[model samples]
Target: MVDRLEQSKALASDVRLTILTWLKTPALHFPHQVTGDPAEIGVCVTLLADTLRISQPTVSRHLEVLRRAGFLRVRRIGRWSFFARDEITLSDYAEWLRDTL
Candidate 1:
C-alpha cells in the first residue's frame, strides 16, 4: 500500500487528475483504436499523449505517478503500454478520505 503522503503527492497534480477522469470513460475521450478495444485493452499512451498535447515521455511520467498511487492498472502489449483506472482502489481511497475528513 502507498503511504498517504505519496498518494497525496500523486494526486496533487491537475494532469494526473485529468488522466484519471479521462480513463473513467475512455471510449468517449479517445478515438477509436485500430487494434484493441478501449474497454478491454485500456487507453493507449499515444492517445493520451495526443489528447494532452504533450510528449509521450511526459505522459508516461504522469502515468507513473498515478500508478504509484495505486490509481491505475496497466497492461503491456509488445512495445505498447495501456492504462485503465483501478476502480476498486479509487473506491477504497474515496472511503478513506471520507472517513479521514
Candidate 2:
C-alpha cells in the first residue's frame, strides 16, 4: 500500500496543489503549444513554468513531487515532458482517504 504520510506531504505544498488545479483545465490555464496536443499529450513543462511565473527547474521540482505521489502522470515525447493528472490514482487516493479518516 502507498504511504499515507507521503501522500499528505505531496499535497501539503501550495505550489503542488496549484499545479494539480491548473492541470484540471489545462486548456483554460495554459497556452497552446507549437507542436504537441495539449488535450492528448498533456501540458508542457515550459508552458507550466511560464503560467506559474516560476523557473522551469522550480516547476519541474514541484511536478516531480506530484509524480512521485501518483497524483500526476508524465509522458516523455521527444525532448519535452508533458504532465497530466492521473485520474485513477486520484480516485484511489480519495477512496483511501475516506476509509483512513
Candidate 3:
C-alpha cells in the first residue's frame, strides 16, 4: 500500500535511521533537556538537534515526518517539544525487520 511504502521511504533515509539509534541512547544522543527529561520520559527537540549536529528546524522537520507516520510520540512542556519512541510500533518495526532479514 501507499502508506506502507511512504513510511518505508521515510525510514529508508540514513538520517532518520540515525535518529532512531540516537533515541536509544539517552546520555550521548541528546543534550540536557530539563523540561521533558529523557531519563524520566523522553528526549526533547532542542536536545535532539544539538546531539545530531543539525539545526533545530531541520531536526524538527524530520521528527514531524516520523511522528506523522506513527513512528513517534511527542510531548510538550511550555515551549519545549519532546519526543519518544512509540514502543508498540517500534517493536513491530523490529519484528518486521527480523522477519525480512
For each candidate, give its TM-score against the true structure: 0.94, 0.92, 0.80
Model 1 worst lDDT run, 10 consecutive residues? 30-39
TM-score of 3: 0.80
Look at candidate 1 and tell me the lDDT of residue 35.
56
Alpha-carbon runs more than 4 Å astray in model 1:
none
Which digits, one per residue and each the tens of the lDDT, describe model 1 over residues 12-36? 9999999999899988887577658
Off by more than 4 A, model 3: 97-101
lDDT of each: 0.89, 0.88, 0.76
Ranking by TM-score: 1, 2, 3
RMSD of candidate 1 to true structure, Å: 1.0
Across 1-101, the per-residue lDDT of candidate 2 in tens digits comes to 88777878999989999999888888777757765667777899999899889999999999999999999999998998999999898889989899988
Model 2: residues with Cα > 4 Å off, grouped in runs: none
| Candidates in order: C-alpha RMSD to true structure | 1.0, 1.2, 2.4
Output the better candidate (1/3) by lDDT: 1
Rate residue 77 of model 1 by lDDT: 95
